[model samples]
Target: MPTSNWNIMVKASQNPPFAAENYSIAEIKNEVLLQIRSGKDFPVTSAAISLIGQLTSEQEVPVAELANVVLGDYGLTSKLLKLINSVYYLRFGEVTTVSRAIVLLGTDHLRDVALSFTLFERLQTDASDHIINLLCRAVYAAVVGRRIASQTGYTNPEEAFICSLFHTLGEMLTAYYAPGTYAALSKGITGSGAEESARVRTSLLYLSLGKEIAQSWRFPARIVCCMEKPTVKMSEHDDVYRLSCIASGANEVAHIVEESLDPEDRQRKLEKTLKNVHLSASLISGNGDLTAPVEDVHKYCSLYGITFERSAIARSLNQRREENEQAQGPLKRPTNNTAEDAPFDLPPNFNGSSSSPFSSLPEAQDDSETVFTNGLREVGDAFLEECPLDDLLTIILETMYRGLKPFGLRRTLLLIRDARRPAMEVRLSLGDPLASIKSWFSIPITAIGSDVFNIALSEQKHLFVNDSTVPPIDGQPLIPSWLVEHIDRPVAMGVLPLHIKRVSIGMIYLEGEKNFFTTVPQNYLNYVKILHQQAAIAIRQR
Candidate 1:
């Protein structure tokens, strides 16, 4: 599915009227879940439901089995791996595989990652700007919750993350599954007299519906508890109550940040909200720096592929940062040199762009190289940290997939030798139409015969064919006939072999469009080789 804003209003006219006042909460909850389950995105919903069940089951789920469940979905696997490797979770080093991530970060963290992605996936459909804004607020709340958990030394910060993320589940789902009713309730609850009753009823409806979904999804008892507005005063000794406070407070802060334009008004509202929850501003920002939480929100947005600039909360936060910076004025640098002593002369014959040769390249290509360079650094870090073999290989493959994207990299396949059979099969792939081509990419290995792919594996050499249709001097085509018959003949291709203790394991197959490998820099090719060598080292270590 395409990653875009979710369009809840697309089927709004077709939706039945969801009058919360008429039916019992149970009836309404069941109806909503049924509607969601029967909708067009049921397959995605079902998969998420199944994964949640496995993660939260009473019986112990084996590490390998759990990892398999996660890896079964391409998007989930990609996002989960990325989340685990993010700065927030990167404690030991780079985590590559779901199994190793489970071992290192624990199952609770993995469960939260899965939940976060599921929520993100649901809200990411093509939608109105308002709905997208709501989604951004939820993400902001979750990020704040995680930070609060960390600052307060909470044992399970992931729990805090999930609690805060789903804090507005009731409101968000109502908006998504029943936009008309949401709009009606939203409008009706904004005044005195009968409006106050409407407000109370609306709150109850949202809260009850959210609770029902949580219960149906088998969310932990504590999470469900945290979803509700805390009615009682928080006790210092009650950790769960404190956690609930954090979740609720973070959610309120998210709303305040988005809804309030004036910094003073926002800060005052934030302070009041935190005070009501028995939390201090310092708990969120250790030094009472209000802008800290806002910066963290932007950082998390970047980490999760969210368009930070488009978020209303982000704009509000930016304003707050600007105001705060202006209030404090610019900082003075501690310089030992006088104004005349400081060197300010430009080098001889130096143009602004003379410092880097890449200045002449397109911005996208430069960004691509930067991504590849970062990927190489990550792989090197993983090696130093002795990251699990499977995880390291995944990182390497994902890096190559993302880095080569600018070169018209359409599909990347990792064909590994099956231990039990003399055949190379597609172990992993990245890019579109994978289901169509993944199954057809098996190559039989034989001592007597030679194909370009087999030859690269056997000889442990890299091959770059700019155009597969052109016959080499040997009059042999680089791409096998079977491949051409099953899939579109790629205009350009790259084959980098992987080895373990001098024995061939697999090769990374990169397929692209016209002139794919022609203009790529030598340094980029060297980076690719380094990534392959890192994979080899990982294999040998295994």
Candidate 2:
């Protein structure tokens, strides 16, 4: 359901003389926009729409700019990082920075990912079954389209994904903005023209509305073109036309998969659709595995947090896979007796043993160690990729924050020397979100002081205070009075100075509760120092 005004307007359009035919396309488009704006969540929706437009625009957006946009949205940043680190993209190793992700995944793929997330967030607020089904189909189509593009050797599979995902944008928006009209259109009305004409008009209404919105959102020309249904006979050589065919064919395949038809019927319909689009049957059954794409769909659904089990398409696809597997029977192993062809098996002495030999081995590394190891590897990869300075610094800081969590890491801040000022200021922070505390991170470089922070930076050394409240034998406090007044005496703290060619530039400030530093293992502390070294290296390289 939509706003009352839009519902009334759509319901009124079904009457004689005031029907949809009487209204110009422009009028309908304006009404749609107005109704969308009139909704209660328009402000949030408008911002998301604007972000999608920026992400998907045709112009070349700088990596830093794109990374900045993504970093501004905490949820999107977290999800995007999670997706990049998922098994799907794990071949690229761990990506800790948005800029690195954009570089590895390409702007097109990340743009589509961002767009899908934005649309899902905006439309799923009051989503009904219809909306959920549409969203699933959209994602399913994108996955299928990417497969088709890869099979056909298209230059950009991600572009194909975007085209296919947005193909149903108009229908989805219609269902959200004017469910009554969408329902009425779903059940066709008796018209004077041929059934095909009526069908064409109905399809055009949705496509045209989608095109209008695409234009408003500044989506690329190829995406808008793919939104339209392909002509009866399209040129296979034209890239845009080929993408359009792929999108249309993929969407049709999605519909066929969801149908109540038997496996044979569904296969026949799928083949027919692919043939009409000039695609090979191999796309459907690559290497005789018909369920690969279905499995991929499920993986993507998990990444997007969509409940694939609830989808009719998922059920149908699973049923098809089961039937295919049943027909193939149980797999038989090779009977060859050659030593090289022998199957892997456990030792005879261990097979029937009650106790396991591995029981005496040391346990696996803890989560914090894994985090530190992964962070180190990610930093190494970033260096190999020649990651931009800002992004590399972000990775270093984030690594330290996450890896030190087991040691009660409360907040970590990167304070860099201001180029035009006599003081260092907080450039990046993690694990804390208090603006007041963040602002207090500034340290005047020229101020004569021997406190822990100043000492670390001036001497280019690392300082770890196990208990800030205990004064040294000199009867002078190590913790500065200003820090005590503002932060109310942090129980523990660590400072690692950043230097370029032996000249101090800044310091990393870590604050936590009691036993933060006392509890940290020597190896973990070494890992933190390694991360600090990487930050210094990044700064030197820059």
Candidate 3:
């Protein structure tokens, strides 16, 4: 039996006054929160059990009425179902629906289920990693609590579930409302304590809040007292005390498993906890092939006629122990997102070289023939196979340099649109390093001297600058000086459209004096045209 140090009425009095003898439904709910933190899982569990009676009685709850309640809190219903489906439930695989969950889990479990629904719903929105971690830890602890209930043959599995689930409700609210402060405290404790650090003190603050809420709600005295003094003695035969012990041990295990504690000390604590529970040390060690899978554990327990209740208590503890053991090893941190994490950048020339008759002339007649065709096919194929998006752009620009070197084209620039920033940023370049080229690489789509920029911005691939003498499109010189100085030689330029799926991607700028194209071999010019199309497709896909 559970004992109490605080009166339910006294605790309820701390909140708005309410009649305890003939308590209303809201008052009963208020008390439910109190009982949870008080370490008395039974009263709340009992109330949930009582609800089962009401639900199944001759006056069955109207299906529409139940639907409205469930829809009002869809997340709660979902979580309840998930919990029911978890390894915690005895019927494990068969039951699924909320209605079924209520029937199988009982009224006592339902109340606790409702509490868990509210608890996590609140925690998900919290910003503090510390509190979030604590929330996770608390859930693990709740797992322990439910396991204990199972072992002790607690009739209401949902009550045990709720008790474990909301035992750390204070932590949930703290993480939700004051994450920064919680984070600071967590940092301070971890930095100082290594494995020796104990969060029990920090957690007590939230425990107090749980206690306060329980008292305000007018929960049973058995639970109210436990909330007021968590250290209170439990009878050797007290099932609730056993449940609380399992939860307490589980929380400590979570920290150890996450390696948030000192290695040697964490090991010692875990070993002692396991010994006290008569569990196998190898189960938590996570050594070579020694760990038990949940299914195996279930099988083992069933062989002994052990209910899921006891199995849950045992399994969660051991799992956390294994997690802690793993955490004891050196930590591996994730680095910044690299090119490998991104998709490939599609080039404008995905269709390959056109087979048009105009592109087969000899090199001596067409100077631009070798510009983009030289090694263009080989490099483009290699880039598609090997390069990541960031480096792909660089490789594409380099490929352009390799292919166009014989043409005396001297400079090439690639600009790509930034989705997040929604602007054009310079991607690749072939020019003097001192020309502020970096800034030119990623110019805003709305501003720039590049024909590619104009093409992408206007969704037009047919832009052309037949005459530099024409007025600048936006009061700026049509031919940028960067282009003039970087080219190493003056030349007229032709901007031809690059398209993919009828959408404008970018433009290929062919530079040379007028009639230069008449001199360059058509085969090489065809290569440049093909490269442009591939480049357009590549960049767009990225």
Candidate 4:
């Protein structure tokens, strides 16, 4: 949201409000970049990556020298052999050793193969579907971009392959490092947003993150330029321009194919996007002057799990265009086309015409209740879902953020109720970085008011203060001094206590845009209540 107006809100999206966790979005990037520069973030320049880089270069790399690097890691050697041997379609003889595979695949083809396999081996984590999709897109784009590069007669298609492969580096890194922020931001990502493609959401976010890492690693000037893809115009046959165009085109096509559920919608969008890269629908569909490299696209799809035919693609694109022609309607081209390498921009602000605090409220599709219930079920598992203590709290906090409609609340905090101290300690704050990891929001368990959030925790009841300035129960200003010390202004808040067999354990506190807390229908509030009650039941008696 923050292009200034939502800076705090957008910044809070990642810089989790935890103890001493206050950081601007820029600061968060600097911190992450520092770690990356120190070789602490992602394994970008591992031995395998370095060796693959050498293999990808123009100079002839000695087979014995390349094999020595591969031989250092038993796992890498085995994988190299298996991958080479598995490419039965290539009709290559079985490659039983890394040395032979290197010689057989040759310098150029070998580089492409090694880069893909090395990256797969390095960045592979216990990834979720979103993360896996991110990884897959990088690899998919690499293959597709390489195909495009070869057709366009780029000097080094291999270079284009790698550049396109890491185009989403920022997005993938965020998903891996800060799944919390990744999950939080993921809801509104529908690919084509009001200003840019849905993928632009993270792209806008991670461009800086990716650039810093790429630069720090001292990658080639052209590759780093490709990563930033700064606003510029280039002549035809400009190597940099061709690389950027092919990579961008590949990614756009991959997104249209993979993310969109509606085939007709997918086709309609793909044509408009390809235009930005100076590619026509006819070229891609093989109906143009240049023969379409349909085989390359199909091979990439089959190698990955895309599992769709070439005819299906042509049918979607051509049929949609035919329908538009018959109606005399011009197909709408999205104004913010990242595929063209347009000046990267943010979506309009939260209160601006395009978005809102509730922009991403979970839709039920056809069944309303399942939306909340299914989410709660997942949260229930998380509450008891054993994890490393550090990660356990993060999962709990993130689950709570989603369990409550993410877009519905401005700020929510997880508080650990301490009976002996008669107070609550703010453990986590969602969407409010100032409250995060700080005791600034703590309130005594026995706050001297009927509507105070802590009273809800102490009494094991759901407490809703419709207006903090005026009491809902008896027309008194129930907002306590402890709360006033923390809140800069009057605000409404709710607290639902966690209990085990009706025994109070802790509480969940949520605050929204002033009176917005009161506007939530009781039925929706009950969903949050049920979430707490179910999570409490799952907590083992300890």
TM-score for candidate 3, residues paired by index: 0.38
Instruction: Provide TM-scores for the models.
Output: 0.60, 0.67, 0.38, 0.47
Once superposed on the true structure, which residue ranges of model 2 sit more than 4 Å away at CA?
1-26, 52-78, 94-103, 124-127, 189-194, 215-221, 231-238, 261-272, 275-292, 318-373, 384-390, 400-496, 506-530
Best-to-worst order by lDDT is: 2, 1, 4, 3
Q: lDDT per prediction? A: 0.65, 0.68, 0.44, 0.54
Per-residue lDDT tens digits of candidate 2, residues 1-542? Answer: 22333334444644232344345445555566555566676566557656656654647654544654665566677678777776557688756555567778877777777877776666665457677777778878887787778778898887887798889888888778766566665554233422554455557778888887767766667888999767766666789889999899888877776766875676688788888877787665532222233445655655555665566675665555455458885434455643222222112222222332222322212367876787788788888888767667766776676667667877778888899988878777666442444566677775554678777777778988878776743665677776777665447989898988887788889988876888888998999998998888888878
Tens digit of lDDT per residue, candidate 1, span 1-542? Answer: 11110112222322574444344435545665666556676466646765666554636544444554565565676666666665556565654444456657666666666776776676667365656777778877887787677767787777887899888777877777666656655655543423354456557777787777767776667777888777798666787897898899888877776763564665577788888887776653322223223434554554454555676765655555455458776423336844222221122232223223212222322266766776777677777778766566766776676667667777777778999999888766656333445567788887843667778877878988888776654766567788778555547888888887778888888888867888777887787888888777777778
Q: Write the per-residue lDDT of candidate 3 for residues 17-127, one digit (tens) a residue.
A: 334544432443344344344433434433443433344342544322232234234455445545555543544343323434454554444544454445444444433
Model 3 regions more than 4 Å off: 1-68, 81-97, 148-158, 193-203, 217-233, 260-265, 273-542
Stretches of candidate 4 above 4 Å error?
2-6, 10-25, 34-61, 86-94, 104-112, 155-157, 187-202, 218-222, 228-233, 261-264, 286-542
How well does model 2 score by local distance difference test? 0.68
Worst-scoring 10-residue span by lDDT in model 3: 341-350
Give per-residue CA lDDT, model 4, range 119-180, as digits (tens): 45545543466566666557656766766776677887768877887777777666666665
The residue-level lDDT of candidate 1 at 542 comes to: 80
Q: Which candidate leads in lDDT?
A: 2
